[model samples]
Target: MTNLNPLVIAEIGKMANELIVTYGKYKETKEIEQTERIRIRATLLALTKKIEAETQTFQLFLEKRFEERHRLYDMAEDLMKHGMKEKDPDLINSAITLIKFTYCEDPLKGNSLLKITDTY
Candidate 1:
């Protein structure tokens, strides 16, 4: 129609959607197809959520790992400030061991492996 208000158009669209849902395909051959389409879209959305959650969990693991390294470095700096000239090799070795270790230590959390180099 001519110059319909946007709100009116939205309401009309909603009405059309309701009609389609209520009477469009229940008695026709398209019912199975429409249902399958909805099912597939739902499945895809679920999979996408799973992937996103996994990615976020992975990022949290990485952030925790970096925090761990920051703690270790801060420990070293504190030790140096106390007149120790060299970093204790044991601390560095511990960092290596921690990096290699994962969920074997945690009962509630599953650790994701993060690749950290020796530069820091």
Candidate 2:
């Protein structure tokens, strides 16, 4: 799922929408044969189902990624607290490094670690 591309999802959505519009036009005008209409409906249904599945997969991937990031942030926070309590420079440095890595990877997100790291 890591290789899943957002662009591909977007394109599938666009294609599904276009198919919906096309199906509507044909239904309104009754211009095409019934078999052709049926085929279009089937294609649209398949695409809609595919989009739904892909969307779910993407959502799960994001959730897992967020959980991993939160775990890292919590670990870093714990390390920082212990380091400060024990006056350990190495632990503090390691915590700062983790915070920087997290911030650098997802700069758009509001991270408490950013505030903590800025003081050091």
Candidate 3:
């Protein structure tokens, strides 16, 4: 059996730790690394779920807003037509403002899909 002096063993252990720290070297087991990887994956999954829920809610709100804007546009166009026929300057001006506020073009009908945000 080889015998190591107590002080020498302690110094060697300290030196080993120092070497590892300074060199940025680490040992990882497959199971331990997999556990950590799974934890990270679970965290990412949770965040993805939350983002998906938020996106769905935002989409609903967006659809409702789009519909409301279209309704406002229709009202503005009707007012403009009526006011033009009657020569009402104030009504015409108000109709123009409403049209400006609600005048978004229809979305492109092709395959120009909206982009999803990228995750690291």
Candidate 4:
């Protein structure tokens, strides 16, 4: 087995697999079970595809949410800096409002009471 070439090894493996599928009862006690197994495998494959699609969608949502959060923070910082330089209380209030609305909004609501302090 160790001395066999890769091609021969692969052929032997294929043959063995064929023999098993042809002869092995596996979990099937009758013809109906064999058909049921095929159906089960098809369902499993569909479920796997659905799960992958859902995971990709979730990742995209997370990335978009993160970008939105960063954009909001950047806007708030710029407004705050401009407000301070011009000594305008209205601009400063706007900045504060932006920060409060962005972070303190808490999308998760009271389900997660972890509040966002004035870190900015």
Which candidate comes out best when scored by lDDT?
Answer: 2
- As a whole number from 0 to 100, the lDDT of residue 7 in candidate 2 is 96
lDDT of 4 at 22: 71
Residue 11 in model 3: lDDT = 100
The Cα local distance difference test for each model comes to 0.66, 0.82, 0.78, 0.79
lDDT head-to-head 2 vs 3, winner: 2
Candidate 3 lDDT over residue span 13-115, tens digit each: 9999999886664444656788999999999899889789877876776777678777888999999998999999999999998887666554322222245
Colliding residue pairs in candidate 2: none
* Candidate 4 lDDT, 1-120, residue by residue in tens: 259898998999999998898776653567778799999999889878966986786666667777888899999999999999999999999999999998876544433213434332
- Model 4 scores worst on lDDT over the 10 consecutive residues at 111-120
Model 4 accuracy (lDDT, Cα): 0.79
Between candidates 3 and 4, name the one with more favorable lDDT.
Answer: 4
Q: Positional deviation of 92 in candidate 1, in angstroms?
A: 11
Sorted by lDDT, highest first, which candidate order results? Answer: 2, 4, 3, 1
lDDT of 1 by residue, 1-120 (tens): 389999999999999999997776665657788889999999889878977997898887778876776675566556444433455666555545554453234422446434434331
Clashes of each: 0, 0, 0, 0
Q: What TM-score would every model get versus the actual structure?
A: 0.45, 0.60, 0.57, 0.62
